[model samples]
Target: MKKVTWKIQYDSTPLIHRHCKKCGKKTRFKSSDQFRINAQRQYLDIWLIYKCTKCNTTWNATIFSRISPQALTSEQLNQFQENDQALAKNYAFDFDLLRKNGAEYELPAFSIVGDDIGTGESAEVKLISEYILPIKVSTLLRKKLHLSQKSFRELVENGRIKDASGQNLLKSKLNGETTIIFLP
Candidate 1:
């Protein structure tokens, strides 16, 4: 079978959802791409900063709390202190960390990077993601293939499109990597 690969490319960091005391309601917060560090004698506390999109209020997402400065190497600590963009991006995309901080997050904008499948082509397509997002498999396929709900449903029902591992294509959430097969 012919093989194709698609990579998920996020355009922005996730927007955090939580109550903004200043706004008096839940609001989306965008990452400020900055880190705040506090030194308390022998311990250090670190956080990634976020701002309310609607009100510009600030919220700090805890990265490390009351941890010893020695816990991280000098290079790591320097990166945090300098507000490294890549390091900030890594923490900003951490869904589990966001949930642990009592905040919900919306997935950022993304584009699928790959060539489109030809008509009636039989192929194995691998979908890859750098981050474990909550996007659904069906949504990705339908969006990338420009298929309507009815057309996508028909293809799935008729077995013209299916998960390589037998996952329910309509209900499976994309996590890391997934393979789908197209049959002529």
Candidate 2:
């Protein structure tokens, strides 16, 4: 985690206007800091926090909300339960698929993976997640660890590669499996 510091002006809630004493200018604020409520704070985030663009003023702000961290309305709780149930079912199905399939998987292209999937390109990447060496990183290990890719797969399937780092990475990849993709 990094340190973060914020410099802001103390202004009224729903900060609307600011008066520049020097210029005798009053202009409407373009946007509200409330929009940044979703941001995560770092340890010393000095400049990352909001600052006034017009007068370079700093402001403190506040908002009111009744919901506690654990306070989920019945409707929200039900929706969350339903979502969790659906996720569990889907995860079970995928787990079974992965169990039968071995490492290497395919998923739609989006975000970090947007460059990888969702096209006429075939989705059949290699399944390396469940196998000892994570499929996505297997090729790299093949060179660095001086391990044969074929032999590595055979070793992993046979319960051989038992190092702590290897095991953890394999586990994480299986949990957050990336779609197997072909470079060519």
Candidate 3:
């Protein structure tokens, strides 16, 4: 099999150093994925729980407010009921949910690994999100590929490589595969 792709996996752990209302300072919250479920008639209320790193104060990121039990799939219910970290990681990166609760969030730290699949002049870098989202990749490429800012800018200006969206790949949000081509 010819290996023609490089895979980059992002870290899903949140970097949302939010301000704890109780602690009165900015603190990082850790997601427990352990939900507090309450049964109300035919509705199920769910909340993804978190804790303040500094003061240990708990905060609830509501997932469902009296949602019908049938609304969630069997797998989703299992994931929530069993405190699945992967599911929680997805929720932790939910910008809408985070903003709805008036919580400040920062981008998570990412670790990028390039998998060499083929020896060729052209290479495809597949960016996979651990949190099921798109993330900016210019900084990542600079750090991983060791390209200076000026050099990166030149590449974008010269149209050497396009991003996932098929445009100049400067600071583009990467969620899928991108092709990097070497020019003669």
Candidate 4:
């Protein structure tokens, strides 16, 4: 087995530069890739994050560190900002549901709690609290967001996915071209 060697090439800043064997160019350590990093640990969550500035060839590196606020330097602060943006994309805001006939339902015949609602379409959607709508309506969220039959079913089978909101993937109504009449 070949012996491993590491050189501490950091200058005045908390940064280091390394010369890559694949591309004989010097690469600087990105600040984001430097936090919570354990150079010796190669876990799946541990990003092997060595990169060449010139060639942009990203590999991995391990460093020892713990999760703490002080560990969150200016560099890590930037990474946090990037992480927050990614977390926000998974959900959408509430949309009011109205029937296709321009009429609305004032009361649900009965309340549905902890039960499967409508199918892929035709489900009623409402804002939180008093803004609730009894209208047989849906957010039309399905068309905008879809799992592409294969992936959707796969997710269901894996059990890693579940619909706790009791939504049906089958029921349907409304098309993409439905005209929108804003409530006054």
Candidate 5:
């Protein structure tokens, strides 16, 4: 069987959703790509800053709260103090941290990077993502293959497309990596 691999490439960081006191409603917040550090004697606190897209209000997402400065290496501490872009990006994409802060997030725009399979070709396809995302498998497949809902549904129902484990692909969400098989 032919093999193909697809990688999901995100275009930007996700926007966070939470109540904005200034806006008096829930609003989307975009990351400012900056970090704020506070040192209190022996402890240090770190936060990633975000701004309300609609009102420009600021919110700080906690990274480390009242932790010892010695807990992190000098390089790590310096990265946080200097607002490293990569470090900031890692924190910005952390959905668990966002959920813990009572906030929701929208997924960033993404493109599937892979070669296309021709009609009636048997193939094993692997889908991979760098981050754990809550994207629907059906949506990704349809977008990459340029298939309509009806066409995609028909293919699934007729056993042309299926997950490697035979899970219902239509109802499955992609977390990190998934394998699918296309029957000729």
Candidate 6:
């Protein structure tokens, strides 16, 4: 049988949090799906709003500043006007917006799901992180694969599982193309 290998890639999952000026502490925020728009003569100002999880304080992340109506497509404008939840979820991961507003963020948690059986005695797996943020590979692997500490250590000792780059996967932050070989 051909060796079963997985070329894994994932999108950036941002840990969205903001400091609550009212509560005087860092708090998780949820997308409000609410927009505040203002018409300044011919230009329009738009914001994507978020509310603090604890206190319900509002934070406005600027989507556009003085943008002409002609600049937006009808669909795009309608999405903003209607407060699309899907669009809001995408916006929730906007690190640029969070950084612009001087808000604090954490690394997002991620997991991988796959079938139990691989094609051969060994399989090549690639882990890709779309986010600019670094992820802890060892912990993620342990959690995702449901492996015990002893089993993981044994694999490491026997060199049955190793990074394709020959670097230590345990200490490194997983990003870009990280290839791992799993021995059955």
Per-residue lDDT for 1-184 in model 5, tens only?
9999999999999999889999999999999999999999889889999999998999999999999988999999989988899889888988999888777999899999999999899999999987777778999999999999899999999999999977799999888899999998
Name the runs in model 3 displaced over 4 angstroms. 1-4, 10-12, 116-120, 132-134
Residue 58, model 5: lDDT of 97
Q: Model 1, range 1-184, lDDT digits (tens) per residue?
A: 8899999999999999989999999999999999999999999999999999998999999999999988999999999999999999999999989998999999899999997888698999999998888778999999899999899999999999999999999999998999999998
Per-residue lDDT for 16-115 in model 6, tens only? 5767899898788766877778889999998878788788898888888999999999998898889887676556666667778676666554556444
Error of 2 at 129 (Å): 10
Off by over 4 Å in 1: none
**What lDDT does the true structure give each of the candidates?**
0.95, 0.33, 0.69, 0.32, 0.92, 0.69
User: Candidate 4's C-alpha lDDT?
Assistant: 0.32
TM-score, predicted candidate 5 vs. hidden true structure: 0.86
TM-score of the candidate numbered 6? 0.64
Q: Supply candidate 1's per-residue lDDT for 6.
A: 96
Best by lDDT: 1
Model 2, stretches more than 4 Å misplaced? Answer: 1-70, 79-172, 181-184
Off by over 4 Å in 4: 1-13, 31-45, 63-184
Error of 5 at 36 (Å): 1.2
In model 1, residue pairs whose N, Cα or C atoms come closer than 3 Å (at least 3 residues apart or on different chains), thus clashing, are: none
| Candidate 1 TM-score versus the reference | 0.89
Quote the RMSD, in angstroms, for model 6.
4.8
Model 1, 74: alpha-carbon shift in Å?
Answer: 3.1
Off by over 4 Å in 6: 1-16, 108-111, 117-120, 124-139, 146-184
Model 4, position 66, has a per-residue lDDT of 39
